[model samples]
Target: MSGQGPMRVLAAMSGGVDSAVAAARLRDAGHDVTGVHLALSAKPATMREGARGCCSVEDSRDARRCADVLDIPFYVWDLAARFREDVVEPFVAEYAAGRTPNPCLRCNEKIKFSAVLERARALGFDAVGTGHYARLSGSATGPTRPVLRRAADPDKDQSYVLGVLRPDQLDGALFPLGDTPKAEVRAEAAARGLVVAEKPDSHDICFIPSGDTRGFLAERIDEAPGEMVDPSGAVVGHHRGVHDFTVGQRHGLGIRRPAPDGRPRYVLGLEPVSRTVRVGPVEDLDVTTLSGADPVWLVDPPSGPLDCVVQVRAHGGTAGATVRVTADGVDVALAEPLRGVAPGQAAVFYRPDGGGDVVLGSATIAATA
Candidate 1:
């Protein structure tokens, strides 16, 4: 850790205030920084109907302007082909398979860490950086054993989305604004006259700018009307497609009649083979144990069944649990029953220390008991 040369870093600029300030912080820290914007969207015919999300053309221009203000070299890399393949395609496939998938997690895994980082390493950069609101501290042994931590700004902490990062990826990642609050970051950018200083944070899913997943999926995948059944195997309603429903979804169910008990019915499960959506009482949503595949551990694997907190979704409250780790992943039994534990959603594990280091990586929830 003593006197290592200023790290050659590539900052992923999304043309937003957060990323712009992140890049500025890295430059101010004396790191040799370069900015690159991933061109994820293709050009639209009209500006008014443009894709204006995080990866939109307007954001890319903002990134360029921020890079210029920082006096750093910047480039636009076309990742549209790969983004579509890695993020958009699988999104459709998951829905086709009748499982709701987290496209943001896929983007972090396939695009940011996989494709972009690979390109950065190939270009001889020592590390890659992003505007994510997370922190990374070098391991006791140095950068080779990096530890992922949460951002100082809890409201903007992106550790949930980034919990899937691997050790090697962490080794070559930098989050210069991790310890700084978002407001201060914007203040710093404004004081420095950066153009993106006042831009609002992009909240919608980037690729689906219209935020109409149902319409989007219907356009991409063929839809055949499917039966909606009650928990007792009685046909209660019909659905456009099994993919259009989720575990706790209530609206657009098309079930006009109320349940006999006067309590509302919710989507309890999706049967892909039968193409049926099962509706049941809200109590049907409660679950105690969850087991899944393809687990990614941030720290060393747990020696034995260990106690930790499990989060079934982003911003979901942490629940007490005993986690049993196997070669593939971990199985968790919640201390108290939880609702909305859906398949294909991420379950992230955290140590009780409050450091925001994801001791265990997130996984798509495979099952709930």
Candidate 2:
């Protein structure tokens, strides 16, 4: 994607202002750009109005209209079948196994980068560009070895979700809007006369457009009611399903009694087999060590302990930590305890480089202590 000469770029547009601006930027940069809107939903009529995020039927039309204004070829690729098999099913399975899964990250990994990029390359496209708020750096040679970096706007930085990408995916990826702030992008969209300039950013999971995640999961998986117990295994309350809870959750636990110390009880663990929701003081949620599986490295895999920043969630769960590469996975020693580190969530490691903390790599959390 780091070619100075014009290159054939497949721009993944989700009918959002960010994507529209991204495609326009690429086109202005003189690349042969084609806009593609991925159809992830089998039944678009059932989705929310105006395609919030990337799953709605209206999203395709919006993307088409943007392409028309930019005077570029546009196509809607139906990836619903693959989306269901790769992203949706795994999401449900993770929750069923008593863990929280970030489907947005999964979509970026399985669909946008994997499926879309593969198809684009088969059709002779050089790279795939998106509106993701991340930067790409490269060498001076013709075969630009692109390296992923953080965006200028920290609030809208999406490097965490894109952390699952490998070095090859990095070479095939382009983030045109990375250096630009989001406000400037919106302004550029309006100036360009794009239709989606003012479209509100989609925050909810695209599949669960209604934003009722628990309700959605309940419909997919059978309810296995269970006991809510204290750290000592004393039954404090009852839960309808262990899948309805997650580590560090303090609300909607359905626990009626206050703790002996009069503090709100937080969920510490979920045992899906026993359907047990273990609750205790908030302090119990804090842990210093975490093990992550199936690591994907952006840089050379470390042979020994490495110091970096650790982020457990999409936003705000961050700590300075030391990472040790293991035979099966990675062992992290947090400089300070982080609360609610749960299995199935990606532990994205970053170097403390002032340039947006370069994304070192990521691994799925397998266990925590």
Candidate 3:
């Protein structure tokens, strides 16, 4: 790799400190780097003031300023239509069907790696660089065959959201912040005179900036009043819609009376067709086994039952499990019972090698036992 000539690279700058430093690192490495900001929303430019989300007009401007400072060519590519079709619409539909969907995973699978990488390849770029906190390991001298691994900074590791990327996508991807700590990244940004060095990290779904997911769903999905019953078939209360609730949700039940055992009630199930929300004790949420669908393997699929660590949610803890890959998906037998395992959430698998946590792949949870 040392003797190889300069490679043409396209850096996707999100107008954040992490991406700014990622682009700068590529340029410093003697790669022919160009920065591109993705315009993901069609909202008015004036709406970006003090916006606490990524991809805003202000974020694009910040990216441009960083590119100008780095002395690299910069351009903004509008992807609003593609984003709505691939990520936003599917999110509403999954919620309507009483499933909790991860829009970030969808964006990684469809927009960033697929749409952005494909476009870059066609434009003669050898690889696309991003600021995600995930590591890649492979030979440095030959053709790159990336093996996805967790970031050195465990708190900021983003491998869960990126587990949906395929092997082919990984070959053309570069994550420069994988080995760098967030604090060091910020320090580097400041040293480079980048303006977004002190910007706060954005939280919650970017589309629902208000953080009112239930209210957002209500606007898109029609209100369907239905019965809220206990596990014993006794009517407890009523709900506006099943889409407004998810498995293990406790608040907003509208039930004034406590359970007969003086215990708190939780949402156990949701029937979209009948619009029924089932409430039960906390013990009902414990699941020993779970199955997922539409598996995406970064490497080769396992031949038989494989022991791995399973992560059910983005910010949730991992569990030791024996995974058996099925024809349609994979079945995970947890070593201990897991609570609040919900459908439509990703189940990312990892193996503990001597190196570190290696990402095997991921699938969407479909059922639990």
Spell out the clash pairs found in candidate 1.
none
Model 1 C-alpha lDDT per residue in residues 179-268, reported as the tens digit of each score: 888889889989999987778877767877776788888998888688998988888888888888888887889998788888888998
Judge candidate 2 at residue 318 and give its lDDT.
93
- Pairs clashing within candidate 2: none
Error of 2 at 164 (Å): 0.8
**How far off is residue 128 in model 3, in Å?**
1.1
Predicted structure with the largest lDDT when compared to the true one: 2
- Whose TM-score is higher: candidate 2's or candidate 3's? 2
Sort every candidate by TM-score, greatest first.
Answer: 2, 3, 1
State which candidate has the highest TM-score.
2
lDDT of model number 1: 0.80
